[model samples]
Target chain A: MEITPAHYTVLSAALFSIGVIGVLVRRNVIIIFMAIELMLNAVNINLVAHARYLENLAGQVFVVFVIAVAAAEAAVGLGILLAFFRNKETVNIDEMNIMRW
Target chain B: MAEAIAFYTLAVLILGLGVAVITTPKTVHSVVFLVLNFLCVAVLYVVLRAEFLAVIQVLVYAGGIVVLYLFVVMLVNLKRAPEAHEDPRRLARLGLALSGAVLLELAGIVVYSYGRVTPASAPAAAGPLTGAGNTEELGWLLYTDYLIPFEVASVLLLVAMVGAIVLARRES
Candidate 1:
């Protein structure tokens, strides 16, 4: 029995779309952040799958980079959320109107 | 046959937990659900024969990063619950419709994409015994092939860490 790489690719797409749905529909800031993580992990899945199927290590290396970027994004995003909460007293995404024209 | 079962099972668990994470009302509950989701993905990585990555997924995501999220959640007293003012009916309807449509579209795409592709699970080769399975290989690659980006990630984390501390500090 052989599981081709296509399975992982499709699964990744599904996972990514799920994350997109969460980002679009969820109003909670924390959940949305988690959704963003989901999307990044989804991308990682695609990268790993490609690496395996192609017998190349490039995609795996790319996933490593993705993880690093994700870490940076999480730290900064959460920090900004913390600071924003200090001022506004809430983490609701809709309430982030400070930058709104 | 075994691989088929595993794939189906992992796929169900991954998607199920993902939905749960997003749909959970409380941020804390969502975070917990997200952890479970990450674990399921780790298992999926094992199935894909990326053993190193599977471990990395658990260590970094489940262990290191999620704890950070949990700390932030606990530190910020969010008992008020999210979106206290939004109309529940509208939001619920929107979520339901959106997720449903997305799920349907995904399923459709997958089914349609399989015009000629049947699910095939090749027996795992003895292993990446050459060295691919070893953490040392990963580290070597990271330092040599990826050294520049690797250093940049560290500096990025450093900046983020300090920035988070400053931003999250108590005003008093």
Candidate 2:
């Protein structure tokens, strides 16, 4: 019963699937944002796990970049969400059918 | 043995919190659960011995990004959680089925690929940062191969900051 890198992958994959489910099942824009963050963090875990297992530092470096990107993305994304909420007075993503079929 | 226990525990926590974040009826609660999930992920990073990544994950994700979400949630002032009610349309159930199928397909892919690729038997103790390999190694590679992307990320953050200011400005 060793915790291998594969275990981390399985865990990350499960978390990633939950994020996907969040994206699909939930129509709350803020929830969707959180789900997207979950997905990103899941990917980061996978990267760091492989880096540690293989004794590669590059992957952890990539994780740092990923964190930076997530921060910037969240800032802009939430601001846009705020603007949309202000105008629409609701954050229901389903009602945002501007380009939907 | 202890590692396995911690792994399983963190795995369950991450997955459970992830699901809760998505399925919660309240957006604020969902954001809070998401922060918990991120914090659990940071702990997993610690187990991987990526201490730098774990610290960054906690700071950038649980602290910084989650706060941004909380602010947006408050600013939005959503009394009723958005998308609380699923559409009454006929396709909702079908969409669920499709999503489940896709997840199954992905899981199958993971199993098949993992089966084909045999894992190395031992976890070597070659610490990534030593005299030969250090965060300096990371700095070298960053300045060499990924310099452009590194600079671009900075620019992107600046742009995002400006864009946020513009988009969320008080009405003139």
Candidate 3:
């Protein structure tokens, strides 16, 4: 049997679900960040699959932009994480309540 | 037959590594699993015929981003595991339920789209990229149609670099 877009979509959904679970369940900020990356990967899979199915390059083009944004996000996020670690001496999400009113 | 086999194998590896990244107790181990997951995704990109994207996935994700994650993991040497300080009031079960709802909603959308939308007929004639190769086609489009966004992305990266440096620098 030939693989279809549905197959790719299902895989993307499953991977995205796992990423969601990771973000929700994990207390470590770094793990949550990694989960976000997984979610982005899942989205990229969907984009590329659709690009192939639709016979268009737009989806792939968008994926390039998505990757760029993800890189920027990681850089800024990890920097913030480093600063947070310096001050708090921890990476636990629950303990990061300085802004909580 | 080979495509099917390769696709399934890569899919399984990607999903399994994703789960391992999340469930692994040690942060460093999670990062390692994440690298494997990225590699599998890159392979999937190759299977999808996006050769350029596959290479970019490996270079940017596995090489650049993963190393950045490893650096942060090593720099932030936690005295205690982050999981130990879970607040009693934080409802883990509720979070799981909410995420399950989101998953179900997304799945429903996927099913609906597949069922309702008529699949577009595959292109019979080869597009412009048939002779120029995937990377060349991508570059031509990137420089022509998508030039504005491409430049914007560069600006965004520069800003992000400055912001990261400022954020990470110790206050004098």
Candidate 4:
């Protein structure tokens, strides 16, 4: 059977759903960040697949930007995580309620 | 044929590792699983003909980002189980239900929208960089059509690097 764009979309969607589940269900802040990365990867897959289907290089260009942004996000986010962990001595989201009213 | 086989295998591995990245008890193990998941996605990018992206995905994601995660995990030395104190009001099940609802909504949207539109039968006429290779075409577009955004991304990275240092440094 030939692989179609829809097949890639379905796979992307499933992977994204797993990421969503991870973010929502996991309490560990670090794991949540990994879930966010998973979601980003899923979107990248969709972008590249459609870029191939449409023969458009712009989608690939956008993927490059996405990677750059994801890198910056991971860096800043992990730095924040380190600072928070130092103060709270925990990585659980439940304990990260400093700003919660 | 081979493409289908490879795609299915990678898809399974990607999804499975994504699950493991969340469900694993140990943070370090989860980081390892995340790296594996990224490598699999890089291979899929190759399958999709985004060779430059595949390289970026491997180098920045599996190589750089996951190592950052590992370092943070090691530095945060958990003296006690972080998840030991469960908040009384924490609604774990509700979170699961909400995620399931989102999944269903996404699936419905995909089925509804995709059924209506027909895919272009042929790859659209070779794009502007018709004669160029993948990386060359990407570079050309980055320098020409996307120069401003590319410059902006570099600036964003620089700012983020500074901010990260400021945030992670110990206060005197």
- C-alpha TM-score for every candidate: 0.84, 0.90, 0.96, 0.96
Per-residue lDDT over B1-172 for candidate 4, one digit per residue giving the tens place of the 0 to 100 score: 8889999999999999988998999989999999999999999988877888899999999999999999999899998887888889898899889888888888888898888777656455466535677899999899999999999999999999999999999999
> lDDT score of model 2?
0.79
* Deviating ranges (above 4 Å) for candidate 2: A99-101, B79-81, B84-90, B119-121, B127-140
- For model 1, how does the per-residue alpha-carbon lDDT over A1-101 read when each residue is reduced to its tens digit? 54566677678878887898888787788889899999999889888776765556667777777777787788788888888888888888777778973
In candidate 1, which residue pairs clash?
A1-B121, A1-B122, A2-B120, A2-B121, A2-B122, A3-B120, A3-B121, A3-B122
**What is each model's TM-score for chain A?**
0.96, 0.94, 0.98, 0.98
Query: Which model is ahead, 1 or 2, in terms of TM-score?
Result: 2
- Please report, as a residue range, the 10-residue window in candidate 1 chain B with the lowest summed lDDT: B121-130
Which digits, one per residue and each the tens of the lDDT, describe model 3 over residues A1-101? 77778889989999999999999988999999999999999999999988877778888999999999999999999999999999999999999999994
What is the DockQ ranking, best to worst?
A: 3, 4, 2, 1
Q: Which lDDT value does model 2 have at A74? A: 87
Candidate 1's C-alpha lDDT? 0.79
**For candidate 4, lDDT tens digit of each residue in A31-98?**
99999999999999999998898788899999999999999999999999999988989999988888
Q: Where does model 4 exceed 4 Å of error?
A: B119-130
Per-residue lDDT of candidate 2, residues B1-172 (tens digit) = 8788888888888888888898888878888888888888888877776666677778888888898888887777766757665556536556567767766876787687767766665566655455454456767778988889889888988998998899889787
Candidate No. with top DockQ: 3
| Cα distance off (Å), candidate 1, residue A101 | 3.2
User: i-RMS, every candidate?
Assistant: 3.0, 2.0, 1.3, 1.4
Give the alpha carbon lDDT tens digit for every residue of B1-172 in model 1.
7777888898888888888888877888889988998998888877766778888889889988899899889878875777775643446567757877876787677667765664454434553534556466667778898888888878887887888778778778
Backbone clashes under 3 angstroms, per model: 8, 0, 0, 0
